[model samples]
Target: MQSPAAPATPATPATPATPAGNAGGIDPIVALPARALSQEIHARRLSSREVMTAYLDHIARVNPAVNAIVALRERDELLKEADACDAALAQGRPAGWLHGMPQAPKDLAATRGIRTTLGSPIFRDNVPAADAIVVGRARAAGAVLIGKTNTPEFGLGSHTFNPVYGATRNPYDTSRSAGGSSGGAAAALATRMLPVADGSDFGGSLRNPAGFCNVYGMRPSAGRVPYGPGPELFLPQLGCEGPMARTVADLALLLATQSGADPRAPQALPGDPELAALTPASVEAALAADLKGKRVAWLGDWNGYLPMEAGILALCEDALKAFPAFGVDVEAITPPFSPERLWQIWLTHRHFLVGHNLLPHYRNPTRRALLKPEAIWEIEGALKLSATDLHAASVERSAWYQALLGVFARFDYIAVPTAQVFPFDVNETWPKQIAGRAMDTYHRWMEVVCPWTLSGCPVISLPVGFGAQGLPMGMQLIGRPRGDLAVLRLARAYEQERDWVGQHPPRALL
Candidate 1:
């Protein structure tokens, strides 16, 4: 999988001219995608402080070459909350379906007084007195938080570097790797800097940084996006928290505003309790989900027990052979358990939930050298597990979830490849090897996103293109175990047959 280095012609960056009242007057308002700039900020024709000062002037021209909006917050307190959302749209009132937009969240999402750094240096000057029911449902669906992003520490790793806000990179190519525990929300929605962000996954941190920053995340369907305060008998759906954008209708308008039902989240997912009132025609009916005659299996590398990197399985096999020329059948197949039994039931349920959530930072001996030797080998490998190795990994995860519900009762969708190698070298922290094999652990080069994070089901990464070092390459999909809106209508029918989120990365990372 390591063949990349030959393609260099991208360096884009020279547009800095359109300032006076920006937003949907577009002019690179970070290439407009949050549902067409939320219908031009709900047809007030854009003036939530001109789309929050054109996303703080495109994060001061591309967030210092992709650090991915780390702690941010005060741009005069986000232009006085976009001037109280343009005086609540000049008192005609009723606005919020992400009304004024401008979010950030996902420094492990907790934001009330903001500064919630889970990119840990002992929560680096913490904060968060509240919020985090998906940031209070993305601020009751009006968005506008404006800071946080970057992660890794408590979000263990996919690679968004951390010791309290450090590495993010890869806006197609800063040095590489944008993938992580939502690598700064997939490098801040791949350079849009934040139109829609928020993320979390477990073994692919929101599908390997939305396939290493091309964009589109979604890990859903484990009680469809709910999350909570702490470990109330953890490990039910091997970690979740969703949404990241650059389209699939702005990731189903931030997954219908981070989904619903949260009696302090006892496995959440009550969703469609009017999906906590998300509108814009239910996000254009979950972005016109179609996929023609639907069938689709195409499991790119699992049969080889995943070593991948033949140029990311030839750009996920040219996007599953362009979904059988869009009539959609596809079908390469390979899922009845064994990427060594889904990596031993994802390393005994993710190292016993990373040793009960970081064994109090490895028994705090001065925060034990700020953890991370793969969190002290997953907290001493879940203190050497063995309840007969978690009942033989819970009887091989219930016969690998009834052999993936018998391959979704004859395949309606499975797919794979959200990353096995493409965006490496952000000063290298993981991938000790891919094509030549060897990576024994440090997230075994992401066991093809830990078998859909142990198949709680509903996955998604998207972006399928570019790789001979020109970077980007996504894929994944999965669905049908609750099938979060049938895996977002087959990823909005292969994102309306490959719009690839309207391309855009090399405006020189700006």
Candidate 2:
């Protein structure tokens, strides 16, 4: 495996942690949640090397079962880097909050000197000269980049599989999928192989995987986290990079690290001036938040417009009962925009963006052969679109945004199932049908997540618990546009009120 280049300037590490203390009885550092782990490292309770070694050992023992992490750096190299962190800590230099943590970014993200295959064989040996914005921010925050997490080919699907690293199996059910683009990251977080992970979302790449793996993943508002230090900065802003974690607090901390504007990304959203006071204990809004009498609209199956599998919607509905218990009023209300319009808007944007994004490779006969069928489909569909089609879709998209704004005027949050179906068989490429409704497109089964994507709002996927078949599912809590912190706080409150967030999956228990 290729080792990423060291940081241009070394970050001063925090005060040295005692490597031998297990006073809390959590001797194995891998067992700690990211928030607790971060605090322990900076408070001198655990050394960077100790955390790195524990993680390495755990990864060796567990990663083979699910194949969540790939292109891992050799053990000696990582330990040596951890040692450097410890040495710098002794010198009394304080690093960023993520000082001693280990992170494996999604495969779609480029890492300096490390292979970033994008789940395609074409880039199997491609080593990048620089990191993507997500990876660079994490590095600047003092995280040790261990390697890349798995994703579908070019991150085109929601199931993590590519010729490069193969499919990532669900940690809870090895025969089932872990969900994708961010699938591998979710699996890694669920199994305790990574303290936290990062991923991107276009059509629920971040949400689906987290739900399938029974972890937390958020798709922050578009531009909130800046998509790139790459070309194509403009147009196709449907997807944005965001954080994934075992808990909401860790998600907030990561969001803070990943947020903030960059001149390189001209369309990026500005950082919150009030974010300086953020803490893991309370991932709240600037003003104090109150749940009393807050209105939440549940768009369950879009009022039967969406064909969800039998058990998925029930799980989401049951999860909503907790909100009302907290003085929140939950209502089953249909959005003013029909499901078909939302699907059309989502499809149009995908065709335009994905077509332009992948046309270069498709134009090359050899490269085109390596592209996935879905990639080809997106490109061809895009070619069939005209400037008129895009204009009409863009116009409709603005109306859809207004429709959502109207919903927000009456509701505090919008709710939906994160996925139409639970984790399917690992060998199957995608669900061909949901609740007997034939899926017309490769991503049709995921239409449930597209509304939030099209709206460019902040949505968090929370575990709704396992289905009758024992496979896990997730519920989406959609907050207002650019309301990243509000949705995060709601998820934080849900994590505390409900008992689902910390329940370990099968692998974590073992």
Candidate 3:
């Protein structure tokens, strides 16, 4: 791979002035969110064409080294989109929430007329005739689709490399990873290849990569964002499409634009509370309210399936202490279910879904060769699951839910480390030996993320602060089921108090 150009020098915490390199020329717009950029365009400070050209130019310059963007649309098409936005502005029309913003979609999500490779050689030239639900929503909100980002094959792993697109390197340290299958999205946002990007999370796909890239990511409550065009769409309710951005407000804006009830997903509505109104101020107010008398629990490590890296636990514990500052009584608590059993259930369910859904492709040796072994393992595990096994897992899952209910009855929220370790090397797969124990499966190393997945609770991964490595470490704020606003409110409060927003990857120096 070619070496990436050195990033520009680090700027101060305040939004840096548009670079002097951009003088009368469209230099790449780095680190700004879609909403903010759109506001600038509405104010006539920048033209949509200039923003598009800046991002397109940046992609051309850096995408070769990072391999983040898998496809770039014709400049004409992007220009057309820009012209539409400009015409709207000319008519004195108010722009939509994301009007005139250029964004990239994770390659796994279908994009109309654009190659959506799913990071596999099998679909190297595949293009969907229709947009995925989220993509359609983004477009309707007036987001200009600049390109598709990279992902692992079938989004089966946490690392983004595949036969179709090469590995996406971390912008912070080229030698480290940008985390996957949203690695490409994270890298692009970190390097300012695009103002903001979209990502989907099955198991930390959004949160993990955001933590790795030092951006903000939220995994909304399942059914909060509709995902579809599949027979068993509701089966894997744990997964959902989510937004990734450089600031808490940007993420909230994207969520507002994309979230709502779909007839296809009857349960995905935003409830009585308005999600769009969530801001750092509201979150701080909620954090300040009733914490003095509220109960809080912290899970330092989950049943030892994966060992906590030395500083990770300390970092999380320190963040948890802030709950007390908000007036909540805090204590370390353990859930009722076994971590191993949770992993087994996740593997069985995920494998079964992938195996049956993708049977035709797996039957072909050529296609199967491109499938990740972990994906194959999931399929095999699913095939072996009996009705009894599934029912038993469901029972255990219910018991785990009950355990959470018990905890919530005593405490308002549960806090845990988002990942056992900070960002690892970009070239390696997940750590094989987490705490000296041989991790038997890809899901084992990510045990903490799954417990909340099974419980179907709304969780937000908030950047607590940088770890000893100078890489960001996040704390998972698991709120009551359907407590999306409350969780986001808490995240906002933490973000305000700590002011960790706008922290950029060192590579942005280039």
Candidate 4:
């Protein structure tokens, strides 16, 4: 583990940002964690123009290799915005922690005026008139909307690629993938193209990419971050927007800004009053939670019911040691509920939500022809679901929720593998097989994250370490429902112990 990168001035055009190794060449400002970077900007130790100029220069140099950030805004306009933030700050009116920071929302997040293509040629010229709720929050907080991150078409797959912007390659190895629909977000954060990013997760969109990239990402409890003010928020609970950053403290602070209640999102969870108490200055202390006597259930591979690539679980088990070292009890436990049943419940809900949402697109013959097979599959499967099937699946989902509550009664957290396989070839679509077993669906390879997804629990992907091939992997520290902050605290504790901070940068970039 490496010590957290210290804050430094923005790199000059001549300064080499990525050199031979993880430690030496990273630009000082690019190396700083988002929280620390925020402090530098807010305190005026670094002017917004300085901060923005450095990032623009960094992105110009770094983003092309990975293709993580797309549709970059005009450089001059962004610097002008940064100057405005500086002006407001000089007037004692700092917008917030993100003032002057460059952030690229995932392509799925609609940005007003700026192109918001969902990685599809069908909407390549499409630009929303208004910002998506998540994008709006970041803009309001003073983040410079530098550009949009690339994502899969319709944000449909765990891998981030689309016909429009190509694929967002893994920064650790450009030959491999960056997982998605939030893959661009994770990749950008890993390479320091963006200080913090917003992403969405229905399946493993958030966790898988974070794991593959060796960064921190969270799929907050359903409604914890109000994914919408969306057209169909009332129906979808499986997917939600989340925060991703290089460090836990950065992740938590970004989560604080993105979370809160909105009248439009009726099912959104109430904001945590405890979260209100968190400031960038005190985030480290807030996250340094004492884990003495806390109990964790390590449900690896779901008792071998789910297949995994070689060395994946071993890496996870090794990381789990951080818990016991904190005086938290780590027990390997298998749930009494059938893993297959839970998977079915997950598939049913996922198909229903995805299908219904894309029905309008599917209905048009010309548009349907433009749809990817995965999107077509989801809608077709959804069409087969009768109200009775929907009702039965809903009942099973409820049963699993109750079943999960029983497990939570005994343990404060459950740890699981964030991804079953490591980063695969960037050009390949999805993993068709794992450990010699065929994946029946495009997403079955990601089933490890499904059970937790079904529970709608707050799950954070903790950067455990790298695999034999040098690809990074993460462990899912899943908290009880609505236990968003608890999960962060535990993730922070594990991160602190691993000391896996400053040193372990993307070697490919370095």
Error of 3 at 249 (Å): 1.3
Model 2, span 53-126: residue lDDT tens: 99998888889999999999999999988888777777776477778789999989999988999999999999
lDDT of 4 by residue, 1-510 (tens): 221111143211111123433435767887788898989888889998988887888888888889999999999999899889999999999888888888999999889899988887889999899988888999988898989998999999799999899999998889999998899999999888888999999998899999888888999988888876678768888889999998889999999988988887888888898885677899998888778988888888877788998777777777776667887878888765898898888878988999999999899998888899999999999999999998999999889889889989998998888999999999889999999999999999999889888888999998777766778888898899899999999888888787444557785455
**Model 4 ranges with Cα > 4 A deviation:** 1-23
| C-alpha lDDT of all candidate models, in order | 0.76, 0.83, 0.72, 0.85
Cα error, residue 316 of model 2, in Å, equals 1.0
TM-score of each: 0.34, 0.93, 0.88, 0.95
Lowest summed lDDT over 10 consecutive residues: which window, candidate 1?
Answer: 11-20
lDDT of predicted model 2: 0.83
> Candidate 4, overall lDDT?
0.85
| Rank ordering of all candidates by TM-score, starting from the highest | 4, 2, 3, 1
Q: Residue by residue across 1-510, what tens digits does model 3's lDDT show? A: 111111143211222222323222325354455656766787878878878887777778777777777788899999998888888877887557667888788998899888989887889999899888889888887788988988988887777888777888876667777788798998887667777788988888887887677677778877778786555756667678888877666777777666777776655765435675543334234333344566657766764445877667666666655655555566776555677777776776666666677777778888787777877777777677888877887887787788778888877878787787667787777777666677777756676787887777777777666655567667788899878767766766666566554533444445
Candidate 4 steric clashes: 4
